[model samples]
Target: MKLISSCWIVDPSTFEDHVALLSSARALKFEQHCPLEVIILSGFNELQLDYVEELKALNVNLNDCTDITRELFLEYRHLMQDINDYEFLCFIRWIVISRFLVNEDYVHIDADLHMQINSSDFLKLFKGLTGTFGSPCLVAEHGGDWFQAYCHYFTMLINDKSGLLQLLGDTEISLIRTNIVSDQDLINSLEKNNRLPTLLSSFNLENWSVFINPLWPYITKPSSPVGFSQNGPIDLIGGKPVLFWHLQNDFVSFLGRYYLLVDLLGSLGDEDLVVKIPKLPIPYLQMDCSLANIIFRTLDGLYRHSRSGSSRDRHKTYDPLSRLSVTQRFIHSHKGREVFSERLWWENSVFLPLNDLT
Candidate 1:
């Protein structure tokens, strides 16, 4: 199977895209040992040479999608007047995928995803599944009475690219042009009308437990352990290990915390500043310094903002300082909404005791 990630680098500041593509490729090649082709679609000319070299070092097949992206923007620019380049790429990616990998079995993970588990072992669980499979985005209640379900494109297993293209063809594009909806919104509409051929799968395992005790705003503790085992970074769901974390909108913040933690550890000399959580293999930063306080406070702010109100409300109240963690934040933010789990925080956090935070 081929593992694909698509990113259109219109801005050089979008470092999370590079991190996502590189880290996932590394995970697939080094950690999972999965015999799958890793393909990346991005504007190669726009990417940094060092970043491109790192991907090449990992044996990633980089496909330059600049020409295709330009053509797509030219044709759809008028219809996509309100949409930005990033959002526009979301719709264009499917067209690119359909044309590029026809009749091929592939998993198209969003560029913001961070993968940990073995691909072969994870894909084995979906052996009997037919047609295309996507992670469950929004449930019936949140989407209204007429809504069936919406599948997130974050982690999609495309066994039938042709069938998927049918859903994204001229008719659907025309509908999108009329309504001016997001790719996910259009997908939800198709799902509501029973037009999608794909199955909505909860691949994220959002309700499943993580080893850490559930932090507030979030009530339940599902039992998945996440930490650096002697083998490497380990994350589990339903007592079974799985593949990838879709950090979604929290990726930039998560990456920021990671780099900040790295810098803090370096500055603190890593001797007495690190502490270990019980039953977890990795050491965490001690919550004593000003920097540590900043981390936790930012985390708390994220929880508050996410739990505040509706999607639009959350967007309006989005705290730039509050976007630091992914695992706990992702779980809590979607508490009453969609279920999308991610462990990027566990991979990068300073491991604060949840009970200690107010």
Candidate 2:
């Protein structure tokens, strides 16, 4: 199965886009043995040279569709002026996917998504589902109450490119005066009208969990402690392994990375593990001085103190190895790079190889 993602760099200074794409590619290629092809706009050149080199090192195929994306953007410019560029990119990506798809089917995932399961397992799951659903497009049903019945575009498997192209072409866009109509909404409309042979399956939702606004704590099972098994982070909830975690937003991504670091450190079984808080880069520290980061840092300090067995707080010391719910296989961090730059853990000396962790 072919895996695809897209990147359009709006900001040149921040490395969040690079980190998201790189992390997703690394996790899939190294852990799942799946190669990822990135359909990037021409704006990719705006990123740092080192990041471009890193993408190359991963052997991530870069398909530059600058002219096509630009032309499409121009066509929809009048109707999309009020919409955020990032949101509009979501729509643009599907157009790129349509162009890329041919005889073979493709799985299109957001750049920020991190994979835990291997390609073979994922393919097996898809085949089983398609046998029953018989749909050209299979998308995960949203887990939240707001759009529970709608299909989420974060992860999609497309078997028919022409069908998708026709659907997009026939979609209508009204002038936006206030709220923006997301591509997800459009896709849902198509599905509702029976114009698209799309299957909104809960099979993916049962395994994938999205952590977005009002970042909720991960559901933990004290009886089945989370730790590294030969299969990777063993977090079982209700006897079911988590297949994916969608970490939406900056602060959430920051926390997600912290949790990941703790899991890795805890796997070592080092009771004396002294995780010194790294000094934050000036830009990141200054830009992300939100209450969430402050609270996180404060709690981090308290947790560190507890690890030394000095805190008098009634709550048990945060045990990295024991807390995570490992049911989700795909851990996605949306809008990564704002608060906690990956440079802290990813570049650290203690960072273990992906092969070792998975």
lDDT string, candidate 2, 1-358, tens digits: 5666667766765444333565555545432256566778657667677877777677676677777788877866555665677667765666655555543455555555444566456554554232112111223222221122222322231234345445445444333321224665555445545544443342454564322221221332123222222233433323345444443443344454455445445665744333343423332352377875676656656555656564565334543222121112234222212222223432223223223332
lDDT of each: 0.43, 0.45
Q: Residue 358's C-alpha lDDT in candidate 2?
A: 25
lDDT tens digits, residues 1-358, model 1? 4555565654655443334455555545433244333333455676678877677677565677667667767776565566776666766666665556665545555544444555565555444332233222211111111122222331221233345445544444342254434666556445444555443443333533222112211113324422321122444433334344455443334433443443345555774322321121112333346665666566656555655688666544423323323332332222111111232233323222333221
Alpha carbon lDDT at 240, candidate 1: 38
Model 2 misplacement above 4 A: 17-19, 30-33, 47-50, 128-180, 188-231, 250-358
Candidate 1 stretches greater than 4 Å from native:
13-19, 27-42, 122-180, 198-233, 251-358
